[model samples]
Target: MERKMIRISGKRQITIPQKYFDLLGFDTEAECILRGNELVIRPVSERSGGEFAEAILADLISQGYQGDELLSKFKETQKKVRPAVKTMIDEADALAATGGSTASLDDLFGTEER
Candidate 1:
């Protein structure tokens, strides 16, 4: 196809010709890509409509697959682990609550008093 010349305005804006727009199915929301040395403009497809970051986040969300179910499962796992963690925390708190009186360096070293 023969390409037509377009004039860049003072504001550095190029007016895309109606013919090219119609041929390429370009709309007001179309995206333009400028590679190393090529300028390509095309209509955004459903599969590629969003910004790259949005697309990546969307893909990550989609891959999560279980949505609320996964969240519920995680909560369930936390519930199962909570008691053990709490027990450990309680033990540590009790140890700390001793005020270090029973935590002698000899006790730590498992040795008799010199």
Candidate 2:
């Protein structure tokens, strides 16, 4: 285990140490949860892609994908999907900026209007 002391700046930003970054492989972003009187900083990991990976894996398995082949395929799929998702998010952001100060599900993701 490793330990370090950190100070919060006037802007309320604390820089996470490089030791922790190297150990955890988390970059730039984290989720801070206010638990009672204490603050819990958890890394926002994109490694697994969780639900997206699961859905893709299920579909691939149905098509006879498995083992190292499955892993390779999933990674390849990730490379392809990430950019498209980013584009959509960029478009959503631009739309939101022009329309309002916020992006809603219906405007950004084409969900049912509320």
Candidate 3:
């Protein structure tokens, strides 16, 4: 690939040439990455989109997981776990409302209680 120079505008933005954009098939929301001394541009098609869902469904079918059973298991796990997390967050909020310092582990764990 031949190196091409792009002039920076007053706002410090450089427009990518149309040839490069066309060659890469980059659409409006394409992502670019800068790694050390190299620049990498990636189109959305090269990324993992709904393909993960397809892969997961294939794996679940291969493992003999029925749709309703899988959903029920997920719901059961969420119901069991959410209450503990909510209680912890509520306790933290109560402590925060007391205007207590939370800057250190000792303060948070009540080690400095007078």
Candidate 4:
């Protein structure tokens, strides 16, 4: 894709070009990202919480985990992760309530990538 220049106004807002808006559709909101020295804008996609679950189940199924065995393992993982997930959500809520900036998911989940 060819790069297009955009000027940020004194208010620190840059108008997203009409082409991007047209392509992404103005109906949905776009998420702005700051990655190192780069800025990225992407439309928010519909959430399917099952995507990761699907991946894990697919891998396990490939390895012969199925039916009752699959369900049992899933339950076990959920039992293990449920509390941690709640804790993460609580922490996120506390931070957001205080208007704090989180650097990454690593900061949120306490799992930093090297």
Candidate 5:
């Protein structure tokens, strides 16, 4: 991680180093998140949930949605992608912490008959 000793202004704002800001693709706005005792400032992606856009559009289109309805459904599904991914990540982390499943390959898939 890159470390910098930056001074905070009287208004409780610190200037991000140009190198870091450019590297992180910072624009006019940033998302400030408090994780534990650490404060993280990240660039706010203009295209949040954009990764799923093509797939969502394809599915919605195949489902016979078009016009304003297609656009509406696309927006709704796009909003859901991030939260759903977060939930999956949380679940995965929990499983990892618990050592995941106990079943072996044989137990799960069964062995060939002798």
Candidate 6:
């Protein structure tokens, strides 16, 4: 882990080290996350909400969505992906902290050898 003490400006803005910025592919925007007691600042993924675009569109189209309605619903569903993922991560972390086991494939998708 590379560690460097940086001075926060009067406006509370801190500059990212050039090495770290280039290494992490920092762009014009970043995502700030607070996990436990640590604050994490990472590059905003260009693929965020985009990876699921095809799947979301397929499902919506299969439901007979078209025209502006399809576009609107696609945008709406895409917006929910990030929040849903964050919730799952938080739940998983809580479960791990409590030493709780997560569901198996059989529990989630059912067993084929019924």
What would the per-residue lDDT of candidate 1 be over residues 1-114, giving only the tens digit for each residue? 777899999998888799887887876667777788998877865432223434334444575736776556444444444455446556655667777557754443335422
Candidate no. 2 TM-score: 0.45
RMSD of each: 21.7, 7.4, 12.1, 8.3, 8.4, 5.9
Per-residue lDDT over 1-114 for candidate 3, one digit per residue giving the tens place of the 0 to 100 score? 667899989998777788888997988766677899997767756333333455445555666777798666444444544454446556666778886555454444435322
- Candidate 6 lDDT by residue in tens digits, 1-114: 779999999999999999999999999999998999998999998765888899999999999999999999999999988887676677666666776577664443345531
Which parts of model 2 have CA positions greater than 4 angstroms off?
A: 1-48, 100-114
Worst 10 residues of 6 by lDDT: 105-114
Model 4 lDDT, full chain set: 0.71
lDDT, candidate 5, 1-114, per-residue tens? 769999999999899999999999999999998899999999988775999899889999999999999999999989987877677667665666778677455444446542
What's model 2's overall lDDT? 0.76
lDDT, candidates in the order shown: 0.60, 0.76, 0.62, 0.71, 0.84, 0.84
Provide the TM-score for each candidate, comma-separated.
0.38, 0.45, 0.43, 0.42, 0.60, 0.61
**lDDT of candidate 3 vs native?**
0.62
List, in order, the clash count of every candidate structure.
0, 0, 0, 0, 0, 0
Across residues 15-105, which tens digit of lDDT does each residue of candidate 2 receive? 8888887777777788787899998887877664545877788877888989999999988876666666767778886897687657576
What pairs collide in candidate 6? none
Which pairs in model 1 have colliding backbones?
none
Q: Write the residue-wise lDDT of candidate 4 on 1-114 in tens digits.
A: 867899999999888889977887755577788899988888765443344576557766787888999988766654545466668889987877787685467766787423
Query: What would the TM-score be for candidate 4 when compared with the true structure?
Result: 0.42
Misplaced by over 4 Å in model 1 are: 47-114
Higher TM-score: candidate 3 or 6? 6
